[model samples]
Target: MRVVIVGAGEVGSNIAASLADSHDVVVVDVDPDRVEELNYSLDVLAIHGDGAAIETLEEADAGSADLLIASTDHDETNLATCGTSKVLGDAFTIARVKHVGFLRTWERSSGAFGVDFMVCSNLLTAEDIVQIIGLPAAVDVEWFANGLVQMAEFEIGPESHLVGQTVQEADQFDLLTFAAILRNGDVELPRGDSTLDAGDRIVVIGPPERVYQFATTASPNDAATDTENVFVVGGGEIGFQTARLLQERGIKPRLIEEDPDRAREVAETLSDTLVFQFDATDTEALERENFGAADTVVAALDSDQENLLVSLLAKRLGVNQTIAVVETGEYRDVFEAVGVDVAVNPRVVTAEEITRITREETTEKLTFIEDDRAEVIEVEVDEKSALAGEMIRESIPRLPKGVVVGAIAREQELVSPRGDTVIEVGDHVVLFVDERVAEEVTSSV
Candidate 1:
């Protein structure tokens, strides 16, 4: 497949890198340096021109492309690029935007902007924050098999009691599957005897309730049975959406916005939420409001630096969980390493959501961990599936070394992937696969 990606920013580059290996990728960028850099760094052909211009599309031969993605930072620019691409070709166009209004407009008529699919980064990032907050000590959370199966990543602190326990000892939850252990920076397949270590980021998949239960074991003190008193530090679109979603879940959170006008606007919009006008950097003001009493503090400020500062402040003030929205996807690790419990990157969220739509028909859901070191993907079992009609242990030999069958959803019931469990046709299997074996594992399964 030939893919044309507009904008050479983080989102566009990530999409290009992921698809470049298996498909013909052409990247169009207004920046000459980015175009030149992409040409040297990746296999894609990068063209220097305005992506929304007809001449640029013609030069890139986008009319014959199989897929066209517009991911510029500017929503108008991305929409215009997609509209232009439609004039050039019948490619399945995907546009990334930051506004919910555009998404609503497109939803009424999906092809309104000539975009086959649209991704709202702000909304996606906020939903991610809400989901992660719902789980205890979860660095990431993704649902598969129509919400029948769940995958989550948890970090084991240096003081965690599970540091020295083997995988077998840590397997206390009935429906949970220990997918893989992320030690240092590498992926390690979990074995019965595999010993847990401090600072290990472990991935688990199972029923949603069991996954939430395992979180208590992962971080007992921080994992609460109920999430109450969430603190949202921004009144931007993401923060507003997050607070609104939490309100819908019956959580009335306190929101702080530096701009008085925006705070007033948000307060008027969300009746359940309490909005305040104050700078998050003002420690005295935060202290007066009992910031330490919050179980979770989400920093969705306009800038990543501000969000990081607010998150660190929340941690310093004794907030159990601090979630921040990172504008740049690459800064996620940096934010996490410094004490942010979870750093939500809008670009990464949008890119991964877009990438999932580009997968094969068999793959129902896909999400990457630590930006592609590993992946948790859902695929349907067919007659040609290697594991079809076979017990999991019997099919292990056919799978790659790094593959772990996490969970299975047969019809509407959850099927635990035990050694003796049989995988029948039409079963949706969610598996954690190391990046090294993704292609081979997906092919065989």
Candidate 2:
């Protein structure tokens, strides 16, 4: 498929790179240097011009394109670019808007701008953070259909009561299903006989209330043998964000901040939380706070080194679990090497979400595999979809090679879909596919 991507910035470039592997991608950027950089770095066509201009879209042969993605930093430019692309290409057009309000108000009328989709980075990023915050038990959470369906990630701990049980046994609650397992960053299609070991990150899907109950039940084991106290290192935005999230969940978080004034400000803002004005790198100060007694320790400091150090120190001091926030992508390996249970990078998370939305053909980012060979995607079954109105078993042969339906979301409920399962219009079907056949499966559906 011919695709036109506007803006060659981080988000735009990532989206273009992701799609270029499977589709014909034409990237447009105002900066000649950026265009040249992208051209040298990836196998994508580059056009250096104003993406918001109709002339530029024409030059890129937008009219014949299958998809147009506008992902500029400015909300207005992105909207205008999408509008222009829709006029020129008359194809599936998506825009990345900054303000959440723009997304809420954009398509108020039938005759509004012909954008097929609108992605609000701020809203998406905020929602990603909020979901993690709201469900502190899960390392990550994905919501479907206005929060009716939820996918959650949890790590199995040594003392977890459900460690010996299989997915089917643990999920006998009748509402939840173990969707996938992330073992050392690899997605595993766990069967009924598969046993969950300590440190394995398992993904579960179910309704909101059922997911909540599972999270609550699993957290006590994952977090620690018992929950008594919490310690957070850093006074930065991430630190405050993490602290606020923990506090809201009734887990009182004690933060250790190096900057006295910043610590005071955070303390004032979150009076309910205990803010210790001390250097996180100072082991003595951390020890004074009885870090050993803390159930879990979180490192959200500005410097990745400090965060890693704090996490290592917490772990060494007998903390059951340690989570840190790492900014640099290169430091991810180091986070794991230091025995950190979870290390979150906001930029990487945000970039992935943005790219998922921008390059979406039929499905969203489902699951990542270890060998980078397969993935799971959630696709909205359109009226023209091959799977629509067809029984799951009947449609298997028609589906693209290396792809199989894993689950289905219909009417805000998750169904462990089988061959007899019939797909309806608007149902979001989840499929597991090898990377090579992703586009084929998506386009076919």
Candidate 3:
């Protein structure tokens, strides 16, 4: 498929990299440097021009493209690009925006902005943060099989009981499967002989209950409990959405905004939330508010530097968990290394979501793990598929290495996959595939 991506920023570049291997990708940007860098680094066409302009679209041959994605940081530009693409070409359009109002408007009316699909980065990031907060100990979480199956990543600490145990020894959960392990920045499929180590990020999939039970074992700190005192910094869209969602889940989080008007606005909008008109980075304010007793502190400030500082301060002040919204992917590692518990990148999340949507139609869901080194994909077993009416032991061996059957959903019932389990037609099959052989796994399964 020939795909045209507007905006050569982090989201656009990452999407181009993901689609370049399997499809024809063309990227447009106003910065010549970005275009030059993309042209030199990726196997895609990079045009230096205004993406919303008709001449630029014509230069990129957008009329014959299979898909056009607008991912600029500006919501108006993205919407305009999609609208222009719709008017000039027959390509399916996707617009990436950060405003929830736009999503609501598009939902109320189909193709409101001439977009076949829309991705809201702020909402996606907030939802991700909410998921992490809901399931403690999990750095990342994804659902599949219509929410029947859950896949989560947990970092093993030195105190974990399974730190030195092999996969076979750690197989205590009856319904959970050890999907993959990330050690030393490499992704590995856990086998009977594979041993888990401290600092290893392990991916597991199973029913929600089973996964929650296993989470406690993986990280004892994630034991189920009520988060009574939650602190949220920033009253921006991401922070507001997060606080609102948490409130809906019975959590009354205190939000801090430096701007008085913004704080007042949020306080009025959120009845359950307590909004403070003060600088979150102020030590005196944090101390006065008893931030030390906070169960969780989420830094959703506008600037990455400020968020990093807030998270670091929260940790120093004895907050149990600190989550920071870092826009740059490179800073995620830096944030984690500097004591930030979880780093949420809105751009990366948006890019991954868009890529999943653009993948094969048969793919019901796709989630990246181990920093895109591996993936968990959900596909339905149809009559023509190779997995139909086959036992796990017989069919799994036929697939490439590093690909494992994680779970199965048959008629709304969750099934933990095993050697004797038979995969029948109409069942939803979840598979863990290494990035190196993702295409092969997708085609075969």
Q: Regarding TM-score, does 1 or 2 come out ahead? A: 1
Candidate 2 regions off by >4 Å? 1-13, 22-41, 46-139, 154-175, 181-202, 208-230, 245-252, 359-376, 380-382, 401-409, 413-419, 426-434
Better of 2 and 3 by TM-score: 3
Model 1 pairs whose backbones collide: none
Model 1 gets an lDDT of: 0.90
User: Candidate 2 vs candidate 3: which has greater lDDT?
Assistant: 3
lDDT (0 to 1) per candidate:
0.90, 0.72, 0.90
In model 1, which runs have C-alpha deviations exceeding 4 angstroms?
none
What is the lDDT ranking, best to worst?
Answer: 1, 3, 2
The better candidate by lDDT, 1 or 2, is 1
Ranking by TM-score: 1, 3, 2
Model 1 per-residue lDDT tens digits across residues 206-263: 9998998888888888666467889999999999999999999899999999898999
**Candidate 1: 10-residue stretch with minimal lDDT:** 220-229
Q: How large an RMSD does model 2 have? A: 5.9
What TM-score do all the candidates reach, one by one? 0.97, 0.69, 0.97
Instruction: For model 2, state the Cα shift of residue 126 in Å.
Output: 7.2
